[model samples]
Target chain A: MRTLLASLLILIVIPATIALGIVVLDDRNYYFISLLIILYTMIPFAMVFESRKPQARELIIIAVLTAIAVAGRSAFFMLPQFKPVLAIVIIAGVSMGAEAGFLVGAMAGFVSNFFFGQGPWTPWQMFSFGIIGFLAGILFKKGWLKRSKALLCVFGGLSAILIYGGLMNLSSVTLFASTFNKEALLAAYASGIWFDLVHAAATVIFLFLLSRPMLEKLDRIKTKYGLIER
Target chain B: MGRDSFSTYHPAVNFLYFAAVLGFSMFFMHPVLQGIALFSAAVYSVTLSGGKAVKFNVIYMLPALFILAAVNPLFNHAGMTILFYLKNGNPVTLESIVYGIAAAAMLVTVMIWFSCYNKVMTSDKFIHLFGKIVPALSLIFSMVLRFVPRFRHQIQAVSLAQRSIGRDVTQGNVVHRARHGLRILSIMATWAMENAIETADSMKARGYGLPGRTSFAIYRFDRRDRTVLVLMIVLIAIVLAGAGMGENTMRYFPSMRMKEQTLFSGVVYAAYSLLCMLPVIIQLVEELRWKYIVSRT
Candidate 1:
């Protein structure tokens, strides 16, 4: 009972407290709240591996990877040059499991929105990015991350964009088109397609640019960190 | 024993405070009331935490301007004074602009009020307030709020570690980059699964979900709480009565006639706004008293 309480406190309570504090103190921005959630979720995972004494080198590597992923994800919004989000989601998924991937992708959306401010769209972003990661994990577990399976990478990129863009369009129609008119719903969906297309294209470009080097690096990490057994 | 002490508030008072703030933010619409609410929120925030109010404004107020500018004009076309016309033939009216400003102001004000309330209302108070009605949900909400930040930090750590292995996912083509991103997701999933298994095992061993789980809290309802609760109820009642009367008789819409604003209406609107700021005021006074007492001691 005590252990359960402790776990609950560490996993849920402490993080919630910090998030609430941020929400209260930081203008109630959903990005800060989302960031808080991701950090909190990681606590238990970190604790589980604490006995392993994650070397300073490993910690530094993790920090850099997170910054790169977040920076890449945010850069897509500014420049039409790359598929930053797709790269982050695929790499996260292939290297982490579905849950971690989901958390990272979702957090990317959530954290990025701090620049934009919180809105009804935050939860949808979380769900969309989360599923992207989850899907990547399933594919990776099936040896899809291998160099010979480069097509799998393209498929994953296209899939993430399609799923995220499609769901967002649906949400825009359902949530915003509450005028209860079919015409209004159709119009909303139609208008939304352009934005979704832009997002989808961005995802494809991001993945195409970053996949190969990221895969080789992840394989190396798996070996060094003993992430893969034998 | 002191009236200004944090421990003096009852759980019921905290609950009422939460309900009133949430409800008012969602539904109230009088212009005077809204203006007062905006002012009171600003005042309360500044007084409660000194210069922290400026930080709050940057984080909350700046974005509200963009939302007001972008969203309000697009949907609402209701106004008498036509400002201009779009090339597409939609009339840009003065009234819509005003209304949009009002809506944005209201949204920002409500958010600020909630932020202030979050600071004043501690987690222990919330846990105590809702423990009886729905302990499980309260516990869950508390936990979720606590963990969100930690989760963000962990993702950062993991991402950095993955990047160091020469998997710089940030520098590549769209398709190749996306595939690399998938790797990160796969690693995170494996870690989550492992964590979930460990958590479930721990929970099972500790006999969670067992019947009759009792929680121990560090607060108790006292005389100060009783007085505060009575005052809040009375204030809320007045605000509601004003709202009901205004709904029946007052013209909230645009009107040509320039009739003098009635004293009763003004008082009622002021009261409503003041009620929204009551929690902040209480906390401020309490903090001041504590400081004074501590200096003397």
Candidate 2:
């Protein structure tokens, strides 16, 4: 029942708020409503995690995974965009469940931003990664995107980066322009296309190389330790 | 991030102050309010971190702001007052230009407020407020913070150990270097897992998350905190009410329309500025009173 409610909140309420925020032209309404939408997105995510009645062991494991995901960026310093953060998030999601994935993704952004600097973009980035992780979990469980290694990589790569890049550009539009113009938005997205492709490519590379080993280790640890079920 | 005067306040107050400044910066789009927000944020940030803030604003924020403003006229051609025409026959409007400046100012003001907040709202305060509410997640939040620096140290230590054995990244061809990096990553992963397991065992021994567990807190919400909390609530309410009444509204669609100054708007402006400057005021008053008490000798 709790999962059902969370799903409704994510699938229904979030999109509704976004549509309302976009339709309203009053800048004040747009600002407050956008923040409210972020809060709405966050509350359900926490609810989903808490509803599992996860024990302290499970919580510690989640924290460890989140830490690894945040630190994973520096491990690939040689590569421009090929960070293992997204792969780690995806692995956690596929192994532990969707809520854990969302937690890792959202918390990775939150914690890293403490070092990288927080701003208006922080919430947007958290939302982007959280949604990406959420989708990855769903896609994995449903076995559609996971039917083949190539398909999983393709979906994970294009889905996370494209959604994140696209949403961030939308936020930039709101941050930089009072009135939305189609031409301006198109140009904005166009300019960001290369970075988006690099991120997508990086996500694909990480998924192809790291997914099996990481998932196997997470699975082994989960069952062998007989940790809390949640 | 060390022991600071603002951190002495109840977490609620710190959270509210940041929220007010951020909200006003984003919601109150009037040029006067926006200007006040930007200027006060600039002053507050400089006072908070001195030359660091100035350097950051110049190197990072100013360029971003310029680029943001400059990019608008290139794509946006909406408004009645056309200032000029582009070679593509698109007319640049005065309204778009002005709106661009306001938006840039808003972005910078919001960012400055967050930087100031980062100093004031340390991770301890963050976890303290939310830990009980979301124990597991806040635990994760604090853990992630504590792990970042320690993990950096661990990575460096691991690198040094690896280099001593001639397995460092700089000691080979591309493939060999990649292998060495992965080796370090694998070691880090093992260490991370083991570290978490050990911490979890200790936490279990301590009976964390147990029933009837009472938390010990250093923060005392005493009389002074209460008074400041009420004051912050009042100021925030006034500013928000003023915004609700459209005192701080501006339009930039067809043409720019800034609300004319009125008595209520002036009061709102004062309240908002005071709200933004409350921390500085508290800092100044405390310093002055302390000096006065000491100089009596």
Candidate 3:
């Protein structure tokens, strides 16, 4: 009940803060405001997760998964945009739970940036990857998404394209242009389509090969350690 | 890393200083203000990281600036002064060209500032600042930071072991190599999971998650930190007052207009310059003091 109330409060407060930011702040400040909104959205999840008083084992498992997702990026340096991060994140969501999924995804995004370099795109990347993990968990929990390989691939590909690619391109447009216009948005999307396609293809391919073993490993870990049970 | 006096302050002080400068750089689009921001950011970045920063600014940021500035007028045609028309019947306006340059400068300036931020605000400092608010998440963050390097080393060892068994990533076609890599990753995951039990047990033995836990940190809010904090707040307040009075922003869409230069505006500009150059100034003063003490000794 407290978690639900917190979620309700977040749902109301975040949009109101964004709307206030857009109304009160200057147009040139859109990038900062949007980044703030992304930061704000992640806070409630963290708050809810913390309030639950999670055990040390639960935190360790999430940390290990997030570290794998980040370290896994280096293994695919030969293939640009072909990373196992989303695959690991999706597997984390499917096997662990939504909150763990969000934590893993967000921390992976942030830690990876520490190795690469933190830029204006850091918050957007974190938000995009986190939301995908979150939605994957929710849909799986609701029985809308299956544990099958084919279905997971489809979902991963679509989410990679629509969620991660879309948000990143929108951020690019926001960062580059002073004023937001339809032409700029269209141009940004047009130029970014090929990159997004490659990324989606990578997600689909990673999920195809990784989902089964990864899920099995996570399940074993849960059974062995008596982790956070659904 | 090049040592700067600013980085020696409290993490809150460092965070506040960067937040103020970055926010000001992003919001204020006046040409003079933008120039001040860009110049100070570059100098401070150089001071923080030395010649490599210069190479980064010239190699990556310069071309990015030109490309962004060139691309903007193509899509954005929102000014009264029509410079020309493109093949797509869009008017290339002077306003858009200028706006593009301004936005690109702002982006580059912010990027440099973040580089400086990444240097000064180490992970421990960030964890310390945010640990209380989000204890579990902060713990996870610190754990991940430690785990990434350990995992990377383990990955290397696993790949080598796999190579000895003739299932190497480098000794195959693309598909085979990818499969080998995935196999190594799978092994790594299994190892990580199995070993993590020990980590959790160790934590449990150490009384983790207990109430009244205290973290050890080297930082303190000393007199120097307080003085610097007060100065930063004063400068930030003056600049924000200028912003409230519309003296820190310029109109650049559909027309070009600027707040008239006045005595108060000059004061605001001075305050902003000081705010942005705070780190560089502090570094310079420290260096001079060190020189004098060395000569006396």
Which has the greatest DockQ? 3
What is candidate 3's CA lDDT for residue B88?
A: 82
Residue range B100-190, candidate 3, lDDT tens digits: 8988899989999999999998888899898888888889999999998898889899999999988889978999998898899889989
Over B30-135, each residue of candidate 2 has an lDDT whose tens digit, in order, gives: 8888888888888778767878999988898899889777777777787899988999999999988887787777888888888898888877888888877887
Q: How many backbone clashes does candidate 1 have?
A: 96
lDDT of 2 at A36: 67
Model 2 C-alpha lDDT per residue in residues A5-84, reported as the tens digit of each score = 87888898878777755554353345456666776878877876776556777788888888887777765656765677
Where does the lowest 10-residue lDDT sum fall in candidate 1 chain B? Answer: B248-257
Q: What local lDDT does model 2 show for residue A130?
A: 77
Worst 10 residues of 3 chain B by lDDT: B288-297
Over the stretch A1-230, how does candidate 3's per-residue lDDT look in tens digits? 76676676578776776675555454556787777778877877877798889888888999999988988887676887888888888888888878778888888999888888888899898988888899889999999889999999999999988999999999988888766889889888998998889889988988998899989998888887777587
User: Which ranges in model 3 have alpha carbons more than 4 Å from their true place?
Assistant: A1-26, B162-180, B295-297
Native contacts matched by each model = 0.00, 0.65, 0.82
What TM-score does each of the candidates earn? 0.53, 0.91, 0.94
Clashes of 3: 0
- Please, what are the lDDT tens digits per residue for candidate 1 over residues B206-236? 7655667666777777788788888778878
